[model samples]
Target: MSKADVVAGIPGAIGGVPDGMASGVLAGVSPVHGLYASMAGRFFGGVGTSTQLMVVTTTSASALAVGSTLTDVDPDQRSGAIVLLTLIAGAMMIVAAVLRLGKYTRFVSHSVMTGFLLGISFNILFGQLPSLLGAPVRGSTAVAKALHVVLHPLDFDWRAAVVGLLAVALLLGLAHTRLRTVAALFALLVPMVVVLVLGWTNIGTVADTGDIPTGIPLPHLPELSSLSVPLVAGALAVTLIVLVQGAGVAESAPNPGGARSSVDRDFTAQGIGNIFAGLFRGMPVGGSVGQTAINQSSGARGRWGGMWSGIWILVILVALAGVVGRVPLPTLAAILMVAAARSIDPDRLVAIWSSGAISRTALVVTFVATLLLPVTAAVGVGVGLSLLLQLNQEAIDLKVVRLRVHGDQLVEAKAPTALSDNEIVILDVYGSLFYAGARTLQAKLPDPDGAHDPVVILRLRGRTSVSATFLHVLGDYARRLDALGGRLYLSGVDPRIRDVWTDDLLHAQGIHIEFFAATSTLGESTLAAYADAEVRVHREQRP
Candidate 1:
């Protein structure tokens, strides 16, 4: 929003281009398209959408899905699809704005988001192999295609190859230096000067950028019918992932500037940018944390910084469209390689891999899924796998310790609080109870055998959100208690927990809910509810 924010956003935006293009290449489309969309979409959205310190650009997941489905095998088809998806994704953003679901991006968790980002980083490196070595990228499998490129490096254009390699070296050098912001420009410039001085080295030139219409593209609505159902579904997944990534950073950004990013507004901004880009058959866009940080670092002074960058791009595109052709593709690839290399966090990856069997499995599954499938699909798969593995672990860790009233004090049912005519049994809970926690509830709860009536009180103060599965399990436990001539008393549910536990979907299946106060340092309201329940139960059993 401020000049400082815009300045910081620029370098990150520029750095993101290669990643975006690499995604396009993976999707079997022109890499150049990614660059253009990122440049324009970011500038306009950065300035026009909101005063938030963020950038909009082509995302890896979105590009991959659009490239795979819309592009088809034909380059033209692929290009068309990229253009179409860019517009479609943009339209979706606009719809989000109109509907005001801007805050919906808040629900994604850090664990899932980290998994998506780390998984994509690996895939980006794999995607770049063909261009890095000068081979024609082919094949559906990432590993096989990467190997093919490596094994047949000689088949690539040598002149282009040499320049690309040099670019990589230059970018790496600059990135580690005090002048990383201008790294890409210098990388491109070096190749341009060499070609001009030596006179066009038989190597393919970027002059083939072809003719992009000189007039600015008019805004238009998306053609939803033309894009297939799979493509839309894939787009939705990518949209959610990108929004997750964007919101994650904004929510966590140090509030030093006293201006935190609004997830819903950012989403609307992205949607608006997409519409603009889509109208022009450009790339789909989303908020970029990298770019937002760069803008801050670069000394930008408000929303104007983004506006100025957009203005700068328009001027450059209009005046120097021809110059784009002379730029070397390899040089661009080299810059990208450097960024990708920097993005991988070996320390973090190792920690995730070695944490435990479930974590290790999640890491492996995410890695494998990222390489084998489209990024959007990969995200969905990784999320599903992570949830499954997490749930399995929760089920094993849960121990529904049964406590019962012995005289005036409650104690473990095994000895001090053993079941008696005058005793009431309580199942104390301590863990999450979401989709991943359902199995624990099922396993820890005892089966009712109707011989002795034991009162069951469930304490859910520490538990998180409740899923349908968990509610059903709890319902069954309650019913069993009822059958055994006992009562079910639920306590220690905070307002947040109460809201989740009482959802219509679960309530429709017969789950009578209760609430209580939280007993923590922060002072929760659930504790009072628990006290009230205890009093009611004690009164009912009085002689």
Candidate 2:
């Protein structure tokens, strides 16, 4: 809100324009739409988000998802379809915020994010190769396009390549200097001037995409007559990509004042931004880690920096349209390539690869899917991989330990090699009993074999609910004990779990089942169950 905040934002705004332009090209929309998205997102998102420095703008991942989704639409109708898709994705984000689903973002594990981002980085690099080389490389996937560029190097325009390489060199070389914040601006402008001075009319520039529009467009509803099931699915996919990437931004860019930011609030803010952006025929926008980082490092004091960033972009569009129009496409592509390279972390990928087989496989599969499949489908693959990894970890962590009362203290002990007649065994269950964990527990349960009427006691303390799968397992175990002329004692059973059992059904099946409260001490529960076993043994032997 201060002058300093506004001043800090100027650099970020200048840097963000080329980024937005690059992403717009990636999304197959006018570069100006990217500027519109960035402007709307920063202004509205700054007003609504909890974080002071987080900037919402066009991102490679969301742009790619949007582009892939609109591929089937006719060229004339693609812009309208993109607008509708943005609106739908924004609506979904708002619904998610209302439902308080922001906490669910934590379920997207680190490995999955690593793979997803690596894939996006590669996508951006390969997707821009043709523009960088000034060649018309066409293909469906990043790999295919990359292969095309590699095979047809003869078609590349040397002048455009020189411009792109110069831009890249300046951008990277200036980072170590004091003017690092404005590196992108210099990188873009220097190339534009060189191309203009050299009379390189053959090079493709932003002007080639049609005249640059000044100021914002009026809000209009997109036509929905051409909407399809695939479009809706693509919107959902974009929503997911935005949320995941937004969460990363929120975590990476903390508020300057040290106040905690709410992920749900940020989610709603992004939703509002997207809605306005779509209304103006802009690409979908979300929390951007790169731009927000730049905003913070440039001394952004509050949300005003983000708001000012949008204001500055608007001012440029209105007053400097001619200057922006002359910017070379190869220069923008080179800047994006540098940005994409920065997104990937070789150390993190290596750590994930060395973590374990499951982590390695999940990372590899998600990365490969992102390269080979559409962006939307790649997101699906990442989510599926994360779920499988979670289940596998849970199954491994599930434990069942044996306990014994040594004098006055309860002590952990190994399971007995064999049980005497009417001897009772007390086992404590730990971890989850849901889904795969339940199956794992069932499989790992010790057999009641080689025992004479051995009574088994299971201690399930602190569990609030019993899953149906777990209940089935218990039923099967009870039948096994009943066959051995022994009873099953479920000690420390919460009332909720005990409710799952029916006395009449147990009696009809002649299954001996006993329940005990978890409130009792473990030693007390085990001793009481042991006393009952002794009494039963004496009564049976009396004959």
- The per-model lDDT (C-alpha) reads 0.61, 0.84
TM-score of 1: 0.80
**What is candidate 1's lDDT per residue for 248-299, written digit by digit as tens?**
5565443345766566677777777776666655677776665556655766
RMSD of each: 5.1, 2.6
TM-score of each: 0.80, 0.92
Clash count, candidate 2: 1
Clashing pairs in 2: 492-518
User: Residue 501 lDDT in model 1?
Assistant: 59
- What does candidate 2's lDDT look like per residue over 298-396, in tens digits? 888889898899989888788888888889999888988899999888899889889998888888888889888988899998888888888888798
Candidate 2 runs further than 4 Å off: 256-258, 415-420, 495-512, 520-543
What is the alpha-carbon lDDT for the whole of candidate 2? 0.84
Instruction: Give the best candidate by lDDT.
Output: 2
Q: What's the lDDT for candidate 1?
A: 0.61
